[model samples]
Target: MDRRKFIRNTAATSSLLTLGGLSLNSCDSPRNKHITILHTNDVHSHVDAFPNDHADFPGLGGLARRAGLVHSIRQENPNTLLFDAGDIFQGTPYFNFYGGELEFKLMSMLNYDATTIGNHDFDNGIDGLLAQMPYAKFNFLSANYDFSNTVLDGLTKPYKIYEKDGIKVGVYGLGIQLDGLVTKQLYKETVFINPFEVAIDMETKLKEVEKCDLVICLSHLGYEYNLEQKPDDLKLAKKTKHTDLIIGGHTHTFLDKPTVVTNGAGRDILVNQVGCFGVNLGRIDFYFNNETTVADGYTIKV
Candidate 1:
């Protein structure tokens, strides 16, 4: 890996690191098609950049700038899929004033493919999230969160399948437990299921049944926890098989690159998160030739 190729803050500046020692340039073939995955997590209603005088992140992050970067990437590659891990609401006055309407509308404009629900998404209650659903053109994936008896019943799907250049991709969502994190009134009647159990089911169905070429987990389970009792993305990766990648949220972890974990079947699974406040964009490119796939990843500061 070349340090000079590492990501920088300038517009569309990209750095590439080959995961699993797989080289994209050396493996190019006529049968290969590339899938570009662009993702964000814990945006928290940051519609505008931080003030230039801010101490830590001065003049950084904004939805408009993110949208421009996404648009440019899409223009360069048509087989691009954009996703969010969770916590699109809260943090700013925009959410308080508009109740996430502006956030959803802006994300829709960015053409987000899917997103998962975070605990903070229920800050104003399930109804508040439900209210902004109409403003979003994308779908919400929540495999472990049962909404059967709630107002969100039938509004969200457990998983979805997407095809890119003849390659089948399966994606699912997982949410964290809200027992102590969220109020009973906010996430009323939303049953929480075990993410590990759901991951087993989702991976089995996606790989063995659906026969997807790539299986991704859009998780709000956080990156890693100091306490081993708390299940995080690293635990999920090691416990599940047939999951190729995990895009995670919560805990606002800023990973410089993707972490590779060995699964139950001894297969490597990649997990990545790009901090919070829409400060950075996570990019992973998968190039497939025949039955083989290779990934390259980087994070661009917006």
Candidate 2:
């Protein structure tokens, strides 16, 4: 089958939007550089697809299928990066039996560039997580979760930068508070700093010091909460200035398209989340030139 047929067969839906006041056709310009970002969130150790008779997502979602889809996309665009927003462990028997080893190994095979830490990721305790690190080829980034006094101290970084086709892409991670949701013993000595505060510091450094062209936040915070005191992805988008996109998880919220939010600097910020269990893959294509950037985003069913 052709690339279009392959994508249409695998993807459930798609959306198109022009950000930074640029036309979609502008992407055809030879001078414009293109980068594709493929992301997943809250996969929760679902290595296999659900049975056809199962309710909800019958015959959907398997790591093998996701890998095939990712391979095809990568073939179409070599300047592509794959990311996970976390909750990579503790849902199915795979995690129960292997304790996250299989998840890391498979994701490595898929060539995931990076991922963040999630609350459930500590279900086997910080030590268990540390033990599985060697299996993961990608880096783990979490700006707010300080591991200074813990076993994970130097294993994770606050942020990372990647240059795709000469375009600097700075990526940072933010995890939700583990105070009430996670037991103290599991995440011992892992300090949870305020996400909003960390966002300010990270974004400023990425844009100014690093001079990155695109800034993305891999957030494990829930999409939204009813409580005003709760910090979520939506709150993070509006409170920050330089962050260009927020890929979120922890709430298992499914969105067919990215939600465009106005940032503090009155710029457009994209926020997206694909529901849990590897059901869908979130894709965002960015076209960049010396002067401006334009993006189109959507979710593909896996």
Candidate 3:
């Protein structure tokens, strides 16, 4: 394929790269409306492309490649949203070398809509996250993490809303219990709240107050823990009423498709997670009608 055609095709695959707001063949007709939600989690600062002969991933994932995908998706669809589920620091040499400055800068460049906080995000302590805050242009959504006494106070919001082509979207975040996972000194003064309660409040507000068409939770509480004990995405989705989808992280789950669960009102709650790094980009395409609402998601390996 020619360079132009190859670039166009590449954008059609990656979540972060798109032409404008849409992807190729994204809109079947003028009335056939579509919105795309592109997401990543546990990226771990893999700034540069992987080595050519790496065991698992070779020259597969990178910020630049992801950006090209985002650009192409946008060009094909008018309504598109891009996000990260967290753990934006550590893993690759970028975090060890630049201390998350590069990751934040790259996300900002790719125009990430929002992101959540993960346990590894505290690897450099609360100060490390705070230091790189200035470089990030997107909002940090964390409803379950109370930063009252920490340096992160006021740096995060419970949730935010986005409207694309009149499709109202409410997005919030849920963090895991950092007690045993992270050091007290690292996440100093950061209070961990009940994830269920936060979800209740956020969904109520989003559904009742914000009047959003769809509600999404960026969860770092893993995908599904030992059934009822852990606060995984499945449990969160069950308790949630207004939440329509949950983009999850922290467990490094590799899901080919989103799992659908019923909420308190018996409404479908879609939950998804794309392994880790830039290896795969999670893409959820929603098709909503005034009569009924619908959405679906799957992974696109990059």
**Best by lDDT, which number?**
2
lDDT of 1: 0.86
Q: Write the per-residue lDDT of candidate 2 for residues 258-280, one digit (tens) a residue.
A: 87777787655788999999989
For candidate 2, the lDDT comes to 0.87
How many clashes does the backbone of model 2 have?
0
Candidate 1 segments exceeding 4 Å error: 1-19, 22-30
Angstrom error at residue 2, model 2: 20
The candidate with the higher lDDT, 1 or 2, is: 2
Instruction: Kindly indicate the candidate among 1 and 3 with the higher TM-score.
Output: 1
What residue runs in model 3 are displaced by over 4 Å at the alpha carbon? 1-32
What lDDT does each candidate get?
0.86, 0.87, 0.81
2 against 3, candidate with superior TM-score = 2
Prediction RMSDs, each to the true structure: 6.4, 6.5, 8.6
Candidate 3 residue lDDT tens string, 1-302? 11111011212344232221211112211333567999999988887677889988887788888898889988999699998999998898789888999899989999999999999999999999999999999999999898998889999999999989876788999899999999999999898999998899999998788777668899999998786777889988888887877999999998887777767755556788999888888888777542222355678777
